[model samples]
Target: MATMQSLAFSSPISSHRPHQQRSHTGLISSPWVICQSTHSSFNGQSLQLPQPRRVLLRGSSKLTGAITMMVKPVIQFIQGTDEQTVPDVRLTKSRDGTNGMAIFSFDEPSVFDSTGELGEITGFYMIDEEGVLSSVDVNAKFVNGKPARIEAKYIMRTPRDWDRFMRFMERYSDANGLQFVKK
Candidate 1:
């Protein structure tokens, strides 16, 4: 079983740009700042940011450091009954970067160790600035596989709903023993 971990840190320079819209599918529209972290990680690899870049609200804002190198964001289960083959999952970020959609496949026999049309899992989540995750929706084909699907939707969010929706992802990640990598 592989253990999953979510890391969150405060940015030295947090500048918010208002009145801008992002061109992403799953992100919410709001005032967002470019997060330029000094130290970052992607899939357990250490990364460094180049410089502070102003993100345009009308398009997809790229995060510098470890995240820019990957083609897509993915969540992999490090420890689970299905640990033999880490489930292949994909993440779609929303325009504002606070919301996300997670997709899991049961179609690949070797990837999920399942045959036939076992269907797929789709999860929607909201992440606050405090790095808490709130489930907006979670759909699954099999009930026994709920944990895997739920965990895959985990990610960071803006602090828009921290008080009401505040829930630490680290606790959940630690409890489930899962690790996530942002590409």
Candidate 2:
């Protein structure tokens, strides 16, 4: 979700060294300037040094790009014969975006009371780009013998699975009127 542009300094500084070289003791010189040796600590000891080389200075480059990501969208859960969109749901994922948990909270106690009669929630489904995507291993939180919140965990174990998840998210976002935003 990012585009990068690279910019580098391209100019070369002139060395300006004389054709006839003059030798000095323990003197250091750069391409830009020459200075007299101030250190006399090397008492009468001659030092051999390498030839002066040209060095190019470069400017620090930045990414110069903007990264955008889609905010998690509200999801619709289908229970029994009823389908409803729950806005109080949250989708949290790992840093790699592979493993995640979807939590759906229901404020209406009647829905939980009615669904509890069956002893277990069955036919757990979600509306995806296609018709229905079955959700598995859904755990529920019960308060006073009535369900309050439900959590569904998902994992994408591979790149292909991640791609499929992205595709589903793309369509789901379109269906839910969601947009990607820069963080």
Candidate 3:
């Protein structure tokens, strides 16, 4: 099994020397360019590329076949007395040590609405912003059979909870013959 630490996010192409000129086909034409020329151009310091960080319920798992599920940014909406309000908050998941416990963190408080009412969350939807839905629409395609029981607190907060949610999603996708493709 490949550990998550081994996965690195490498650039599609390596950085070229600043002095190197590009040809018509966008290929570097210089052969004697200084290797550190590009590094010096950026305030005389070489910028290191960011490494891929370990995210909960992400990356390819040999134990779970070759299918890799991506974790995208999601916004949670709360059901109010008469309307739904989108909070200025988002959901994020990270591994808690090597125990496989999914740790969910947020910048803002996890309160549902301004009234401080609990258990008012109706459903989970993939959204880019408050009112704007995600382009993929995972819910519309991946919801079938008996409705999955979703609690406000167990919204991708722990590994067990996340796994349950994922199983529901995978079941729907499998039944509908839909494959999740990474973009």
Candidate 1 Cα errors over 4 Å, as ranges? 1-38, 42-82, 107-183
Give the runs in model 2 whose Cα sits over 4 Å from its true position: 1-82, 87-119, 177-183
lDDT leader? 2
Question: How displaced is residue 93 in candidate 1, in Å?
Answer: 0.8
Query: What digit string (tens of lDDT, one per residue) describes model 2 on residues 1-183?
Result: 323222111112222111333221212233353324522221222333234444455468432332222222223343443333332334444555444444434444233545545444564454432344456656667789966666554444554454444455444444334343222
Best by TM-score: 2
TM-score of each: 0.24, 0.39, 0.21
List, residue by residue over 31-105, the lDDT tens digit for candidate 1.
443344423232222234344334444447644332121111112221111222223345445545454444433
After TM-score superposition, the amount by which residue 166's alpha carbon in candidate 1 deviates from its true location, in angstroms, is 18
Count of backbone clashes, every candidate in sequence: 15, 0, 0
- Candidate 3 segments whose C-alpha is farther than 4 A from its true place: 1-92, 95-154
Between candidates 2 and 3, name the one with more favorable lDDT.
Answer: 2
Lowest summed-lDDT stretch of 10 residues in model 2?
A: 7-16
